[model samples]
Target: MESVAVVATDRAERYGKQLVGHMSRKISGEWTGQSGYLDFNGRGRVELSAGADALKLELTSDDSETERLEEIVGVHLARFGSKDGMSVAWNRKSSEAGTVQGPYSEEDMKAFAEARKARQKA
Candidate 1:
Protein backbone atom coordinates (compact mmCIF):
# COMPACT_ATOMS: atom_id res chain seq x y z
CA MET A 1 0.00 0.00 0.00
CA GLU A 2 1.15 3.53 -0.61
CA SER A 3 2.26 5.60 2.39
CA VAL A 4 -0.34 8.20 1.53
CA ALA A 5 -3.05 5.57 1.34
CA VAL A 6 -2.06 4.01 4.66
CA VAL A 7 -2.02 7.36 6.40
CA ALA A 8 -5.35 8.25 4.87
CA THR A 9 -6.89 4.96 5.98
CA ASP A 10 -5.71 5.39 9.55
CA ARG A 11 -7.01 8.93 9.60
CA ALA A 12 -10.35 7.76 8.26
CA GLU A 13 -10.76 5.19 11.01
CA ARG A 14 -10.03 7.74 13.70
CA TYR A 15 -12.25 10.36 12.08
CA GLY A 16 -15.07 7.85 11.78
CA LYS A 17 -14.88 7.07 15.47
CA GLN A 18 -14.76 10.73 16.31
CA LEU A 19 -17.78 11.43 14.13
CA VAL A 20 -19.66 8.63 15.86
CA GLY A 21 -18.87 10.03 19.27
CA HIS A 22 -19.91 13.49 18.19
CA MET A 23 -23.21 12.28 16.82
CA SER A 24 -23.79 9.94 19.74
CA ARG A 25 -23.97 12.82 22.14
CA LYS A 26 -26.80 14.37 20.15
CA ILE A 27 -28.76 11.13 20.23
CA SER A 28 -27.57 10.18 23.70
CA GLY A 29 -25.99 6.96 22.39
CA GLU A 30 -22.60 5.31 22.17
CA TRP A 31 -20.62 3.98 19.21
CA THR A 32 -19.91 0.25 19.05
CA GLY A 33 -16.67 -0.34 17.07
CA GLN A 34 -17.24 0.14 13.34
CA SER A 35 -14.98 -0.73 10.39
CA GLY A 36 -14.33 1.26 7.20
CA TYR A 37 -12.04 1.97 4.24
CA LEU A 38 -10.79 5.33 2.96
CA ASP A 39 -10.09 5.93 -0.69
CA PHE A 40 -8.11 8.93 -1.87
CA ASN A 41 -9.64 9.59 -5.24
CA GLY A 42 -10.80 12.99 -6.49
CA ARG A 43 -11.26 13.77 -2.83
CA GLY A 44 -11.66 10.91 -0.31
CA ARG A 45 -14.32 8.56 0.84
CA VAL A 46 -14.64 6.95 4.28
CA GLU A 47 -17.08 4.05 3.97
CA LEU A 48 -18.10 2.55 7.30
CA SER A 49 -19.53 -0.91 7.88
CA ALA A 50 -23.06 -1.53 9.02
CA GLY A 51 -24.02 0.04 12.38
CA ALA A 52 -23.87 3.54 13.87
CA ASP A 53 -26.18 4.91 11.17
CA ALA A 54 -23.91 3.61 8.40
CA LEU A 55 -22.17 6.88 7.70
CA LYS A 56 -19.89 7.79 4.84
CA LEU A 57 -17.71 10.83 5.27
CA GLU A 58 -16.53 12.62 2.15
CA LEU A 59 -13.57 14.99 2.24
CA THR A 60 -12.10 16.65 -0.81
CA SER A 61 -8.80 18.39 -1.42
CA ASP A 62 -8.76 20.59 -4.55
CA ASP A 63 -5.00 21.06 -4.39
CA SER A 64 -3.49 19.37 -1.36
CA GLU A 65 -5.52 16.21 -0.90
CA THR A 66 -3.28 14.76 1.78
CA GLU A 67 -3.40 17.97 3.74
CA ARG A 68 -7.17 17.96 3.45
CA LEU A 69 -7.38 14.53 5.04
CA GLU A 70 -5.22 15.72 7.90
CA GLU A 71 -7.45 18.74 8.36
CA ILE A 72 -10.53 16.52 8.43
CA VAL A 73 -8.98 14.40 11.15
CA GLY A 74 -8.26 17.50 13.18
CA VAL A 75 -11.81 18.72 12.83
CA HIS A 76 -13.20 15.35 13.90
CA LEU A 77 -10.98 15.26 16.96
CA ALA A 78 -11.94 18.78 17.90
CA ARG A 79 -15.62 18.02 17.53
CA PHE A 80 -15.51 14.78 19.50
CA GLY A 81 -12.57 14.70 21.90
CA SER A 82 -12.07 18.45 22.21
CA LYS A 83 -8.34 17.97 22.93
CA ASP A 84 -8.81 15.30 25.61
CA GLY A 85 -9.27 12.40 23.19
CA MET A 86 -6.85 13.56 20.51
CA SER A 87 -3.81 11.31 20.18
CA VAL A 88 -1.46 9.91 17.54
CA ALA A 89 -0.06 6.38 17.21
CA TRP A 90 2.87 5.26 15.11
CA ASN A 91 3.25 2.04 13.16
CA ARG A 92 5.93 0.50 10.92
CA LYS A 93 5.09 -0.84 7.46
CA SER A 94 7.11 -1.95 4.43
CA SER A 95 5.59 -1.42 1.02
CA GLU A 96 6.78 -1.13 -2.57
CA ALA A 97 7.37 2.58 -2.08
CA GLY A 98 9.57 2.16 1.05
CA THR A 99 9.58 2.06 4.83
CA VAL A 100 7.57 4.80 6.49
CA GLN A 101 7.86 6.24 10.02
CA GLY A 102 4.55 7.02 11.68
CA PRO A 103 5.07 9.38 14.64
CA TYR A 104 7.41 10.45 17.47
CA SER A 105 8.51 8.11 20.29
CA GLU A 106 8.90 8.32 24.06
CA GLU A 107 12.60 9.13 23.69
CA ASP A 108 11.69 11.86 21.23
CA MET A 109 9.18 13.23 23.72
CA LYS A 110 11.78 13.26 26.51
CA ALA A 111 14.31 14.96 24.27
CA PHE A 112 11.75 17.55 23.23
CA ALA A 113 10.83 18.27 26.85
CA GLU A 114 14.49 18.58 27.85
CA ALA A 115 15.18 20.92 24.98
CA ARG A 116 12.15 23.03 25.89
CA LYS A 117 13.22 23.31 29.54
CA ALA A 118 16.78 24.23 28.53
CA ARG A 119 15.51 26.90 26.18
CA GLN A 120 13.17 28.26 28.87
CA LYS A 121 16.04 28.52 31.39
CA ALA A 122 18.23 30.26 28.83
Candidate 2:
Protein backbone atom coordinates (compact mmCIF):
# COMPACT_ATOMS: atom_id res chain seq x y z
CA MET A 1 0.00 0.00 0.00
CA GLU A 2 1.04 3.60 -0.59
CA SER A 3 -0.02 6.90 0.89
CA VAL A 4 1.11 10.47 0.26
CA ALA A 5 1.26 13.73 2.11
CA VAL A 6 2.43 17.19 1.18
CA VAL A 7 3.37 20.19 3.25
CA ALA A 8 3.49 23.64 1.82
CA THR A 9 6.30 25.82 3.06
CA ASP A 10 8.79 28.24 1.75
CA ARG A 11 11.68 26.27 3.26
CA ALA A 12 10.92 22.90 1.72
CA GLU A 13 14.54 22.18 0.88
CA ARG A 14 15.67 23.14 4.36
CA TYR A 15 13.22 20.78 6.01
CA GLY A 16 13.96 18.06 3.48
CA LYS A 17 17.65 18.23 4.24
CA GLN A 18 17.10 18.32 7.96
CA LEU A 19 14.69 15.36 7.89
CA VAL A 20 17.07 13.25 5.82
CA GLY A 21 20.06 14.14 7.99
CA HIS A 22 18.30 13.43 11.24
CA MET A 23 16.48 10.30 10.16
CA SER A 24 19.56 8.88 8.43
CA ARG A 25 21.45 8.77 11.70
CA LYS A 26 19.04 6.16 13.02
CA ILE A 27 17.90 4.50 9.78
CA SER A 28 19.13 3.80 6.28
CA GLY A 29 18.35 6.88 4.23
CA GLU A 30 20.00 9.06 1.61
CA TRP A 31 19.53 12.63 0.45
CA THR A 32 20.41 14.24 -2.84
CA GLY A 33 19.58 17.92 -2.29
CA GLN A 34 16.29 17.92 -4.19
CA SER A 35 15.08 14.45 -3.32
CA GLY A 36 15.59 11.90 -0.55
CA TYR A 37 14.62 8.35 0.29
CA LEU A 38 14.38 6.49 3.58
CA ASP A 39 14.04 2.87 4.52
CA PHE A 40 12.40 2.20 7.87
CA ASN A 41 14.57 -0.81 8.62
CA GLY A 42 12.46 -2.98 6.26
CA ARG A 43 9.07 -1.97 7.58
CA GLY A 44 8.39 0.83 5.14
CA ARG A 45 10.06 3.39 2.87
CA VAL A 46 9.60 7.10 2.33
CA GLU A 47 10.43 9.23 -0.66
CA LEU A 48 10.72 12.95 -0.12
CA SER A 49 10.76 15.54 -2.85
CA ALA A 50 11.66 19.13 -2.15
CA GLY A 51 10.19 21.79 -4.34
CA ALA A 52 10.26 25.58 -4.19
CA ASP A 53 6.96 25.79 -2.34
CA ALA A 54 6.16 22.32 -1.12
CA LEU A 55 7.63 19.15 0.33
CA LYS A 56 6.05 15.96 -0.92
CA LEU A 57 6.33 12.58 0.75
CA GLU A 58 5.46 9.27 -0.84
CA LEU A 59 5.27 6.48 1.72
CA THR A 60 5.14 2.82 0.77
CA SER A 61 4.61 -0.11 3.08
CA ASP A 62 2.52 -3.18 3.67
CA ASP A 63 -1.00 -2.55 4.92
CA SER A 64 0.16 -3.59 8.36
CA GLU A 65 2.79 -0.89 8.54
CA THR A 66 1.10 2.02 6.83
CA GLU A 67 -0.23 3.78 9.92
CA ARG A 68 3.00 3.43 11.81
CA LEU A 69 4.91 4.82 8.88
CA GLU A 70 2.51 7.71 8.65
CA GLU A 71 2.84 8.50 12.33
CA ILE A 72 6.61 8.35 12.33
CA VAL A 73 7.09 10.52 9.26
CA GLY A 74 4.21 12.80 10.11
CA VAL A 75 5.47 13.51 13.60
CA HIS A 76 8.96 14.26 12.36
CA LEU A 77 7.72 16.51 9.59
CA ALA A 78 5.40 18.31 11.99
CA ARG A 79 8.26 18.97 14.35
CA PHE A 80 10.57 20.23 11.63
CA GLY A 81 8.03 22.58 10.09
CA SER A 82 6.17 23.67 13.23
CA LYS A 83 7.65 27.13 12.91
CA ASP A 84 5.66 27.59 9.76
CA GLY A 85 2.59 25.89 11.16
CA MET A 86 3.31 22.89 9.00
CA SER A 87 1.72 19.49 9.56
CA VAL A 88 1.02 16.37 7.50
CA ALA A 89 -2.47 15.12 6.75
CA TRP A 90 -2.07 11.98 4.74
CA ASN A 91 -4.20 11.40 1.67
CA ARG A 92 -4.64 7.70 1.26
CA LYS A 93 -5.68 6.18 -2.02
CA SER A 94 -8.66 3.90 -1.75
CA SER A 95 -7.81 0.22 -1.66
CA GLU A 96 -8.96 -3.12 -0.38
CA ALA A 97 -6.68 -2.98 2.65
CA GLY A 98 -8.29 -3.23 6.07
CA THR A 99 -8.29 -0.10 8.19
CA VAL A 100 -7.33 -1.65 11.49
CA GLN A 101 -3.85 -3.06 11.33
CA GLY A 102 -1.99 -4.14 14.41
CA PRO A 103 1.39 -3.71 16.15
CA TYR A 104 -0.14 -0.60 17.58
CA SER A 105 0.91 1.20 20.71
CA GLU A 106 -0.80 -0.03 23.86
CA GLU A 107 -1.91 3.43 24.83
CA ASP A 108 -3.47 4.12 21.48
CA MET A 109 -5.27 0.80 21.39
CA LYS A 110 -6.69 1.40 24.83
CA ALA A 111 -7.84 4.85 23.87
CA PHE A 112 -9.44 3.59 20.73
CA ALA A 113 -11.29 0.91 22.58
CA GLU A 114 -12.56 3.39 25.12
CA ALA A 115 -13.80 5.69 22.40
CA ARG A 116 -15.54 2.86 20.68
CA LYS A 117 -17.28 1.80 23.84
CA ALA A 118 -18.35 5.33 24.59
CA ARG A 119 -19.83 5.71 21.14
CA GLN A 120 -21.61 2.38 21.38
CA LYS A 121 -23.19 3.30 24.71
CA ALA A 122 -24.34 6.73 23.60
Candidate 3:
Protein backbone atom coordinates (compact mmCIF):
# COMPACT_ATOMS: atom_id res chain seq x y z
CA MET A 1 0.00 0.00 0.00
CA GLU A 2 1.08 3.54 -0.70
CA SER A 3 -0.38 6.88 0.31
CA VAL A 4 0.46 10.50 0.82
CA ALA A 5 -0.91 13.36 2.94
CA VAL A 6 -0.08 17.03 3.20
CA VAL A 7 0.10 18.52 6.64
CA ALA A 8 0.04 22.27 7.12
CA THR A 9 3.46 22.91 8.56
CA ASP A 10 7.03 23.78 7.61
CA ARG A 11 8.57 21.47 10.15
CA ALA A 12 8.12 18.48 7.93
CA GLU A 13 11.19 16.47 8.78
CA ARG A 14 10.90 17.13 12.47
CA TYR A 15 7.25 16.27 12.53
CA GLY A 16 7.91 13.13 10.53
CA LYS A 17 10.42 11.90 13.03
CA GLN A 18 8.20 12.83 15.91
CA LEU A 19 5.21 11.10 14.40
CA VAL A 20 7.09 7.85 13.83
CA GLY A 21 8.60 8.05 17.25
CA HIS A 22 5.16 8.53 18.69
CA MET A 23 3.84 5.50 16.87
CA SER A 24 6.69 3.35 18.04
CA ARG A 25 5.81 4.24 21.60
CA LYS A 26 2.14 3.48 21.17
CA ILE A 27 2.39 0.30 19.10
CA SER A 28 4.25 -2.92 19.63
CA GLY A 29 6.50 -2.64 16.63
CA GLU A 30 10.09 -1.94 15.75
CA TRP A 31 10.74 1.30 13.94
CA THR A 32 13.71 3.27 12.76
CA GLY A 33 13.92 7.00 12.09
CA GLN A 34 16.36 8.91 10.01
CA SER A 35 16.47 12.46 8.70
CA GLY A 36 13.41 12.17 6.52
CA TYR A 37 12.59 8.48 6.37
CA LEU A 38 11.07 6.01 8.77
CA ASP A 39 10.75 2.25 8.50
CA PHE A 40 8.36 0.44 10.76
CA ASN A 41 8.18 -3.23 11.59
CA GLY A 42 9.73 -4.19 8.25
CA ARG A 43 6.22 -3.94 6.92
CA GLY A 44 5.91 -0.22 6.27
CA ARG A 45 7.93 2.84 5.52
CA VAL A 46 7.11 6.53 5.76
CA GLU A 47 8.95 9.36 4.12
CA LEU A 48 8.51 13.00 5.03
CA SER A 49 9.58 16.10 3.24
CA ALA A 50 8.76 19.76 3.01
CA GLY A 51 6.41 20.75 0.27
CA ALA A 52 6.07 24.29 -1.02
CA ASP A 53 3.29 25.05 1.45
CA ALA A 54 2.88 21.93 3.55
CA LEU A 55 4.59 18.92 4.98
CA LYS A 56 4.20 15.85 2.82
CA LEU A 57 4.17 12.31 4.06
CA GLU A 58 4.60 9.32 1.76
CA LEU A 59 3.68 5.97 3.24
CA THR A 60 4.14 2.49 1.81
CA SER A 61 3.23 -0.67 3.60
CA ASP A 62 3.10 -4.38 2.87
CA ASP A 63 -0.44 -5.05 3.95
CA SER A 64 -4.05 -3.99 3.64
CA GLU A 65 -3.67 -1.24 6.16
CA THR A 66 -3.19 1.75 3.91
CA GLU A 67 -6.33 3.53 4.96
CA ARG A 68 -5.81 2.82 8.61
CA LEU A 69 -2.19 3.90 8.38
CA GLU A 70 -3.21 7.14 6.76
CA GLU A 71 -5.64 7.86 9.53
CA ILE A 72 -3.17 7.00 12.24
CA VAL A 73 -0.49 9.21 10.80
CA GLY A 74 -2.74 12.00 9.66
CA VAL A 75 -4.76 12.31 12.82
CA HIS A 76 -1.74 12.31 15.05
CA LEU A 77 0.28 14.73 12.95
CA ALA A 78 -2.68 17.02 12.44
CA ARG A 79 -3.27 17.14 16.15
CA PHE A 80 0.34 18.05 16.71
CA GLY A 81 0.60 20.51 13.80
CA SER A 82 -2.74 22.26 13.64
CA LYS A 83 -5.60 23.36 15.80
CA ASP A 84 -8.03 24.94 13.38
CA GLY A 85 -8.83 21.79 11.44
CA MET A 86 -7.11 19.01 9.55
CA SER A 87 -8.13 16.68 6.77
CA VAL A 88 -6.32 13.50 5.94
CA ALA A 89 -7.05 11.50 2.84
CA TRP A 90 -5.15 8.58 1.35
CA ASN A 91 -4.79 8.03 -2.36
CA ARG A 92 -3.78 4.74 -3.90
CA LYS A 93 -0.53 4.89 -5.81
CA SER A 94 -0.59 1.67 -7.68
CA SER A 95 -2.59 -1.33 -8.88
CA GLU A 96 0.14 -3.96 -9.03
CA ALA A 97 -1.05 -7.54 -8.86
CA GLY A 98 0.82 -8.38 -5.68
CA THR A 99 0.63 -4.99 -4.06
CA VAL A 100 -2.24 -3.44 -2.17
CA GLN A 101 -4.58 -1.33 -4.26
CA GLY A 102 -5.09 2.34 -3.60
CA PRO A 103 -8.24 4.40 -4.11
CA TYR A 104 -6.69 6.17 -7.04
CA SER A 105 -8.89 5.51 -10.00
CA GLU A 106 -10.13 8.76 -11.50
CA GLU A 107 -13.77 8.16 -10.66
CA ASP A 108 -13.12 6.81 -7.21
CA MET A 109 -10.80 9.63 -6.30
CA LYS A 110 -13.35 12.16 -7.50
CA ALA A 111 -16.08 10.56 -5.47
CA PHE A 112 -13.83 10.28 -2.46
CA ALA A 113 -12.92 13.93 -2.68
CA GLU A 114 -16.54 14.94 -2.94
CA ALA A 115 -17.44 12.82 0.03
CA ARG A 116 -14.58 14.24 2.06
CA LYS A 117 -15.71 17.75 1.30
CA ALA A 118 -19.22 16.97 2.35
CA ARG A 119 -18.04 15.34 5.53
CA GLN A 120 -15.83 18.27 6.43
CA LYS A 121 -18.67 20.68 6.02
CA ALA A 122 -20.87 18.82 8.44
Candidate 4:
Protein backbone atom coordinates (compact mmCIF):
# COMPACT_ATOMS: atom_id res chain seq x y z
CA MET A 1 0.00 0.00 0.00
CA GLU A 2 1.12 3.57 -0.63
CA SER A 3 1.42 6.14 2.16
CA VAL A 4 1.47 9.89 2.60
CA ALA A 5 4.24 11.30 4.72
CA VAL A 6 4.02 14.75 6.27
CA VAL A 7 6.23 16.70 8.58
CA ALA A 8 4.98 18.97 11.35
CA THR A 9 8.12 20.99 11.19
CA ASP A 10 7.12 23.32 13.99
CA ARG A 11 5.55 20.65 16.17
CA ALA A 12 7.29 18.21 18.40
CA GLU A 13 7.07 14.42 18.43
CA ARG A 14 5.00 14.62 21.62
CA TYR A 15 2.34 16.50 19.70
CA GLY A 16 2.27 13.82 17.01
CA LYS A 17 2.21 11.09 19.63
CA GLN A 18 -0.67 12.71 21.47
CA LEU A 19 -2.59 13.14 18.26
CA VAL A 20 -2.33 9.41 17.65
CA GLY A 21 -3.60 8.74 21.12
CA HIS A 22 -6.63 10.93 20.54
CA MET A 23 -7.20 9.31 17.17
CA SER A 24 -7.16 5.89 18.72
CA ARG A 25 -9.82 6.89 21.21
CA LYS A 26 -11.93 8.89 18.77
CA ILE A 27 -11.85 6.09 16.18
CA SER A 28 -11.84 3.32 18.78
CA GLY A 29 -8.65 1.80 17.44
CA GLU A 30 -5.62 0.20 19.06
CA TRP A 31 -2.76 2.57 19.62
CA THR A 32 0.82 2.49 20.81
CA GLY A 33 2.19 5.92 21.44
CA GLN A 34 3.31 7.40 18.15
CA SER A 35 2.19 4.46 16.04
CA GLY A 36 -0.97 2.51 15.52
CA TYR A 37 -3.77 1.61 13.15
CA LEU A 38 -7.38 2.74 12.69
CA ASP A 39 -9.98 0.34 11.42
CA PHE A 40 -12.64 2.67 10.11
CA ASN A 41 -15.06 -0.15 10.80
CA GLY A 42 -15.87 -1.00 7.18
CA ARG A 43 -14.63 2.05 5.38
CA GLY A 44 -10.97 0.97 5.54
CA ARG A 45 -7.90 0.65 7.72
CA VAL A 46 -5.35 3.38 8.24
CA GLU A 47 -1.83 2.69 9.45
CA LEU A 48 -0.25 5.54 11.40
CA SER A 49 3.32 6.13 12.37
CA ALA A 50 5.13 9.13 13.72
CA GLY A 51 8.71 10.23 14.03
CA ALA A 52 10.34 13.20 15.69
CA ASP A 53 9.25 15.42 12.87
CA ALA A 54 6.92 13.44 10.62
CA LEU A 55 3.72 11.48 10.55
CA LYS A 56 3.36 8.62 8.09
CA LEU A 57 -0.13 7.51 7.13
CA GLU A 58 -1.41 4.78 4.85
CA LEU A 59 -4.83 3.53 3.92
CA THR A 60 -5.60 0.03 2.71
CA SER A 61 -8.76 -0.67 0.73
CA ASP A 62 -10.37 0.02 -2.61
CA ASP A 63 -9.04 3.06 -4.40
CA SER A 64 -12.49 4.56 -4.76
CA GLU A 65 -12.89 4.68 -0.98
CA THR A 66 -9.44 5.96 -0.10
CA GLU A 67 -10.22 9.46 -1.27
CA ARG A 68 -12.95 9.84 1.29
CA LEU A 69 -10.87 8.15 3.91
CA GLU A 70 -8.04 10.51 3.16
CA GLU A 71 -10.34 13.47 3.55
CA ILE A 72 -11.66 12.18 6.84
CA VAL A 73 -8.25 11.55 8.29
CA GLY A 74 -6.76 14.72 6.87
CA VAL A 75 -9.53 16.92 8.19
CA HIS A 76 -9.40 15.46 11.65
CA LEU A 77 -5.67 15.74 11.75
CA ALA A 78 -5.85 19.29 10.55
CA ARG A 79 -8.45 20.09 13.17
CA PHE A 80 -6.40 18.72 16.00
CA GLY A 81 -3.14 20.06 14.64
CA SER A 82 -4.59 23.39 13.65
CA LYS A 83 -2.52 25.29 16.18
CA ASP A 84 0.56 24.36 14.20
CA GLY A 85 -1.07 25.13 10.88
CA MET A 86 -1.42 21.52 9.89
CA SER A 87 -1.84 20.67 6.24
CA VAL A 88 -2.08 17.25 4.59
CA ALA A 89 -1.15 16.85 0.97
CA TRP A 90 -1.58 13.29 -0.25
CA ASN A 91 1.15 12.21 -2.58
CA ARG A 92 -0.95 10.27 -5.04
CA LYS A 93 1.18 7.96 -7.13
CA SER A 94 -1.28 5.75 -9.01
CA SER A 95 -4.33 6.14 -11.18
CA GLU A 96 -6.32 4.10 -8.73
CA ALA A 97 -5.87 6.84 -6.20
CA GLY A 98 -7.55 10.07 -7.17
CA THR A 99 -5.74 13.31 -7.62
CA VAL A 100 -4.43 15.09 -4.53
CA GLN A 101 -6.21 18.19 -3.32
CA GLY A 102 -5.78 21.14 -1.00
CA PRO A 103 -6.40 21.08 2.70
CA TYR A 104 -9.66 21.98 4.38
CA SER A 105 -10.43 25.64 4.63
CA GLU A 106 -10.97 27.60 7.86
CA GLU A 107 -14.72 27.82 7.27
CA ASP A 108 -14.99 24.09 6.68
CA MET A 109 -12.97 23.42 9.77
CA LYS A 110 -15.20 25.60 11.92
CA ALA A 111 -18.22 23.67 10.74
CA PHE A 112 -16.48 20.41 11.47
CA ALA A 113 -15.68 21.51 15.01
CA GLU A 114 -19.24 22.55 15.64
CA ALA A 115 -20.52 19.24 14.36
CA ARG A 116 -18.12 17.39 16.58
CA LYS A 117 -19.31 19.31 19.59
CA ALA A 118 -22.91 18.55 18.77
CA ARG A 119 -22.16 14.88 18.34
CA GLN A 120 -20.38 14.76 21.66
CA LYS A 121 -23.38 16.27 23.37
CA ALA A 122 -25.62 13.58 21.96
- Per-model TM-score, in order, reads 0.31, 0.75, 0.56, 0.69
Considering summed lDDT, which 10 consecutive residues are worst modelled in model 4? Answer: 95-104
Off by over 4 Å in 3: 10-14, 24-35, 95-122
Q: Worst 10-residue stretch by lDDT in candidate 2?
A: 96-105
Model 4, 30-79: lDDT tens digits are 65766777787776787777776777777775666777877777766766
Residues 1-122, candidate 3: write the lDDT tens digits. Answer: 77766666555556666766777675533324433655566667777776555767788886676666666666566555543344445555775322222323456556767988999999
Highest lDDT model number:
2
Sort the candidates on lDDT, descending order: 2, 4, 3, 1
On residues 19-103, what C-alpha lDDT tens digit does candidate 2 reach at each position? 9899999999998979999999889999999998999998889888988888878767776665566767777775543222223
Per-residue accuracy of model 1 over 19-66 as CA lDDT, tens digit each: 655644533323445654444444544334333322333233343343
Backbone atom clashes (below 3 Å) for every candidate:
0, 0, 1, 0
Candidate 2 vs candidate 4, lDDT winner: 2
For model 3, the run of ten residues with the poorest summed lDDT: 96-105
Residue 81 in model 4: lDDT? 67
Compared with the true structure, all predictions reach lDDT values of 0.41, 0.79, 0.60, 0.66
User: Which has the better lDDT: candidate 1, or candidate 2?
Assistant: 2
Better of 1 and 4 by TM-score: 4
Q: List the residue pairs that clash in candidate 3.
A: 92-102
